[model samples]
Target chain A: MSRPLLVILLSIAGAGSIVLALVVGTYPISVLQVIETIVAPAPGVVHDVVWQLRAPRVLAAFACGGLLALAGALLQVLLRNALADPYVLGVSGGAALGALVAMLLGAGDTGVSFLALAGALGSIVVVFGLTFRGGDWNVYRLLLTGVVLSAGLSACVSLILVLAPQAQVKGMLFWLMGDLAYAGSPVYAWLILAVLTALAVAQGIRLDLLAAGELKALSLGVAVTPLKLAVFFGAALATAAAVTLGGAIGFVGLMAAHAVRLLGVSHHRALLPLAVLLGGSLITLADTAARTAWAPQQLPVGVLIALVGVPAMLWLLGRRN
Target chain B: MPGVLSCRHLRLQVPGRMLCGDVSVTFEPGQMWAILGRNGCGKTTLVHALAGLDRAAGAAVELDGVVLANTPRRRRARDVGVLLQQEETEFWGSVLDYVLLGRFPHADSWTGFSREDETRATQALETVELAPLSARRYVSLSGGERQRARIAQLLAQDPRAFLLDEPLQHLDLQHQARVLARFQQLVRDERRLVAMVLHDALWPGRYCTHALLIYDGGALASGASREVLTRANLERLYAAPLAEVSYDGGSYFVPHV
Candidate 1:
């Protein structure tokens, strides 16, 4: 199929999945009722559920997924490693630590989100400081430093989990498992997602050169230091925003990029957009299943993603081999 | 548009050893120079230094009397292009897409590649004889084909000066000849400065106008190819005896048994 047609089809599939998510919740709202509620609304239980609750949740899911996938794609190219993702660089761990600490201090949702963003940025600074030397950025050294720091952050998270009061344990677990129930206005998330997607797509050519290698990109006229900084910050900010809204959702950030590559969308110009669509669809679908699968007893979205994404990615890898 | 690339008071050193020290040389347009040295003799390091990809204390590389250190990376790229010995193989994309990356320094917008960029990339592929494989995945190509594809990418760059490290590696005799002939034609027709690290002494003697031989202990000998590429210089550079033979009015140096 042509690239444009494939992109259109993916977009349609993503929109359809979101619509299905809005209509198929436990309230038994039909698609027609959902459409009516969207187009012409009256203040009712269905209206409140569709517009105030489900719509924002679904939108948050889509934005968070898109952010994660775009971050993953950029990091993969920047690090020249197929396995790189937002979490690989310890961004999510740092964000989670910050959010949990805020919750422990009895801060509100907004405070938690701000702290999370700060922590994510902090991790990026620490990683760069440790790895970058004399204008030389070694990928292997960066990878090692990030992995070690992630492990350190993971230990800190475990220490916090063990020390938290019993009353907050369930909430903390839910957050760590990437629950979207506490997400604020989706407008902020959606706007950030749109802006970031634009910036990343604008640098699509630079990303292509980067994937070849840092030296190759530099020789090709890419300002390697500035481009690396841009990608590092771009991926970090996207992950921070996603974690703030959806609490460190996994799988989408790591798997969505590889999944798109498996489908033969290799170039960044196509990869970035397609990964966003597919990633948004994946998380929206996962969040919907998380809410409705057991109905009345909602599971964490991350649980559903891992349960599904691991096997799917494994299958893709097996087929490729 | 003819210009000169000159390095003054250049020095490069790793932790324990000096690669090159206080080396001064000038490369002019309409000349193809070969940097000849034994393995691990800092030929690659010198190329990187001259290309401004590596910065050493007290080293100064200038182009047409303009300091290279002060030139913006993008502007310098338009005038000088470098090809490393190692090429990235993990990138997944069509050869055409890969080659079009060379047009990045000239692109006006980020939306897409322009028509002129595509035309240049296609022409570069034709020059490298890889036009038929333009649609093939870069990772799927053979070693020689990959080398040619990279050469095509550099060709698409169309810089005034080129610093290539081991451009002939992985190439068969036919490709080596064809690519060298193209390089020779480029230098002759357009007066571009082409400096490359080479292992084969015969190629420099037959095709190159100048040679730079890296001697032991961070010294350099550079001049007209015929003057600097003698059997005595080859023996001193490699610390091994060499036999010189005259073929077609050119001298070829071979390691003596």
Candidate 2:
């Protein structure tokens, strides 16, 4: 009975996203008009502006946001630490390093994507390599190693920024901040497909099995090494894809997962998929705020996540305590 | 229905010190046995080696007449239950969930809790009289309740043999009586083997079918519990006199004050 209640509430919340997205700009469009614009046509620039400019961006926001949140949830379980975030395990630092090097080399957008991905993959592998004991990596050790690796990668990034040409630094700076501007149809299609696939794999009570101690889980016949590898690789690939598209939009992963738990649900089977959807929605909301909070000069969408997510997470963890 | 387990030429050491080496022992099934030793005398170290939870030198731990590999012996874990001291606080789960972990060696990946699994888990909890507190968080359990839950988990495992380290640790007089009574019933009714490490000499003499006394990393004596648990031997083990006392249908020993 209670399970069904969460499902229904989520459906209603899904409908609300359209209204919230359409109604929030300067020269705001009404929900009725936005619906009509979708169904029919306004015949001029509003049609192009609404459909072309805002709609694609909204979907992209949700996609990347949800991806980050799901990644956070998975990493938390795989690492066996409740405080784990998507970027905490050096995943983000590696991506940033990849994107920065690519930019400096003048490898445009595709190069940016590939390098960021390579960085994320490398960092995840490195953390796993350094910390693995027996068939598993202890979360506390992984976290410590990650924090150290991330700091090292970050320092390298700063060194590159200092040494690089001015033009390269500007491009690197933007990629580091992750804007929702360039994400159009092709990026959205590829990104959403990969994310949904990873989400489908991560969603289940099997995730609860990760909460079981390693010895107990092993005794239960869990192929522990392969399971950890699957989770780690899946979450890392999805996260790298997000960084490839959205940059280092901090706290979306942390907030989205934390928010769902704060809403009085702890079961990962329910929390994960919802975290994906709610994560997407939250990032979309942050993107919306980033757009509307200033007229033309825009804030990095990552800033809005920090602003909203910090208080929200603290409140959630506090309330739980 | 007796199962034979024998260890031969076993050795364990750390750097310049030898904890236990060139030692051999065996116990037949359907009998209760006790291992007694001094502090840092390799009692726990020996328990871990015998349970296959730790590696040993020059010996292999065999179960049911087969020499199982260390990794695959986890499959054999369903037959051997162990209650290491203070294992609960290191992890999180409910009392019910903690006991349910006993059934894991039978499970595969899916985390499925079948009806039979729950039934066995419930029966085990009932044996320890912890059924009413099944829903309580594991951390919230009292010292006695935690001990009861651990024993219930061991019972639920339906192990062929039980290997327990400090099995009577962290219980008051009343709770200790309850646990020991259950232990006695298990040995008498089920006629299964139990190898437990006991700090107290009285319980072993009253409950154990066989006893082995160890001090300074060597066996002092071992035989039928009554013969092995004598005051003279206890005095030798503890290096002091112990006042032996007789109480209602049971015998106890204490310091003469």
The numbered model that scores best in DockQ is 1
Q: What lDDT would each prediction earn against the true structure?
A: 0.87, 0.72
A1-321 in candidate 2: lDDT tens per residue? 255686677656655674577667777677777878888986876677677778777777777887788889888778776677888888889999998898888886777777887998899889878988776566678789999999999999999999999867766776678676645443653465465554544434355545555544443334556767777777777787788677888887766766776574555657777777677777778888888889677767887878887887787778732
What 10-residue stretch in candidate 1 chain A is worst by lDDT? A312-321
Extract clashing residue pairs from model 2: A66-A280
> Residue A96 error for model 1, in Å?
2.2
Question: What lDDT score goes with residue A134 in model 1?
Answer: 83
Error of 2 at A33 (Å): 8.8
Q: Poorest 10 consecutive residues of model 2 chain B by lDDT?
A: B85-94
Steric clash pairs (candidate 1)? none
- The true-structure Cα RMSD of candidate 2 reads 4.5
Give the Å error, residue B27, model 2.
4.1
Backbone clashes in model 1: 0
Report, in order, each candidate's fnat.
Answer: 0.68, 0.09
Q: Which CAPRI quality tier does the interface of model 1 achieve?
A: medium
